[model samples]
Target: MKKYRIGIVGATGAVGQEIISLLEKREFPVAEARLLASANSAGRQMQACGNLETIQETTADSFKDLDIAIFSAGSKQSLEFAEASRQHGCVVIDNSSAFRMDPLVPLVVPEINPDDLEKHQGIIANPNCSTAVALMGLYPLHKRFGLKRFIASTYQAVSGAGAAGFDALENELKAQFVPEENSSTATKDSPFPHPIAHNLLPHIDDFREDGYTKEELKMKNESRKILGNPSLKVSCTCVRVPVYRAHSISLSAEFSQPVNVPDAKAAIEGFNGAELWDLPNANRYPTPLQYAEKEDCGVGRIRIDQAFDNGLSLWVVGDQLWKGAALNAIQIAETLVEKKCLKWM
Candidate 1:
């Protein structure tokens, strides 16, 4: 029942702010919480536990006396500060792509691979937002019927790109919709390469030689790690939508054994952390607005995919900032403390 001292890196960013809010909402037993950001945001103030706290510049000394550190900064910042935090006896839960592919680092999804947390050498990597949300519905079904292959197309939000990404989408929409007198000039300062409003960009990250974006590759790679099946085949297409928050995915999964529509619906209904919203009669199913600011991912539109012999088609929606990033990190920290995986000072 002891309280632990915690620090949040990138405290001013979108995902970092969500971490602060979630920690307070969940009533985590935190003795003290430190907010750390870059020099540009060093003097900014944020609320935590009903008190105002100032953000300090993150450095090697930032982890002093902290028991657990949650990192949501970019991969570069995590790569630079993760070891320093660990050296200070702090367990780090990183929400970036920095350590996901590292052989020594464990890519974790609490429901799928909670046991991997025990083998951590002070650092746990949260999977990509698209991967996390997609797996929330798929993992449970995979347990019932062995998974043979996965194919997904993601509709990602602007917030996933950080605050600037949101700003860009706002500015683009204003310019495209508002009257000429009220509209401001749309510039290149926005996150995406082109306007995101009224447009669906088929790219999420850098393009590979094969034309798949980096975000798409993450879904393929991270899924294999979290599912504990290195041989699991996966293909994905990641797209950037104009939404402010939450992400949705259209998935088609092939199983090793034959899976019928009724059984798939039953499996989704009984799964933990997932809910089935299928009602073709009412024309209702999961959507980004339905899952935004919520913890559980909503899944629906279950049916047999005609593309593969044993394939099932489904859609999933989840708050990228919550289940995809902050909540997942907090859950990992909670699991560690609850299981006595780490000692509080």
Candidate 2:
């Protein structure tokens, strides 16, 4: 096996750290690992793939020696440097929304559209975390029953907002235990509009003019792109939950073909990236805590929907960090390798 040189563009953050760990955990044949961050994080030392390396400030030349670069930096950074990395002969698997809808860049979920990778001119874009989780369950059913449209409600975790979001929740939880006099210690700079502890926020990304948040719209757009169903109507309500990790989605889908509980169970179980967890009698269903680190998204609560002639309701959960961000990017990288798309100079 060829060990390719790898770079993590935002190595100090949560998703970047997860990407590094997954590269090691999956034994992705990494010949070298480079950690790139902003100037502030430069000179910081971390160990990955059995070696300690200092994080380097990203420059135009950062991808010079890398065969592949997994980017978890925000959209602005990706937009600035993704093409630079590609020009340097590195394949970029970007985890931001910067180029997802670009006709040139492949918006990919390997389990659903690995073949789209071959068309990548330079970069491949990972879908929004919630969209990725929702599709893991929805795609299997879409395959078995021709999907027409879906309505989804997502219960997302704080970690999706990065370290600050996690810290805010921890601070809020700790404040409850402290005496009233110690209230000054509580901080409220959380990216969330209100406290995320014991409360739900009905927003994820910024709202579009149409009243849907960017997160909600991404599910609709990205699903259509991945499913090759531009006509696939998706109505989603994205909510941020108090969970520390993972994301859960409740989906009601209307398929062109009729759907049944038993057949839906078979479709979910038999699918590649999703597992059937519908044993409600055993209290067995996918939840944030249980599916927090698992690679396979779990689906359960499959039942015929009463609203439409061919509608079905289902519940799904998956680790946002795994299947959503890092794991999906790595899977795209793996697909590149398997397809022999990585050519040597």
Top candidate, metric TM-score: 2
**Clash number by candidate, in order:** 0, 0
Write model 2 residue lDDT over 1-50, tens digit each, in one string.
77999999999988999998999899999899999999999999999988
- Ten contiguous residues minimizing lDDT sum, candidate 2: 177-186
TM-score per candidate: 0.95, 0.96
Candidate 1 local accuracy as lDDT?
A: 0.89
lDDT tens digits, residues 1-345, model 1? 799889999889999899999999999998888999999998888788677898999999999999999999899999999999999999889999999989778898887898988888888899999999999989877977788998999999999999888888888777674334534344578777766777678988799998888899999899999988888999998999989999999999999989898888888888777888899789889888889999889999998999988889999999999999999999998889877887433
Per-model lDDT: 0.89, 0.89
Clashes of 2: 0
- Badly placed stretches (over 4 Å) of model 1 are 177-186, 343-345
Candidate 2 regions off by >4 Å?
177-186, 343-345
Query: What local lDDT does model 2 show for residue 306?
Result: 86
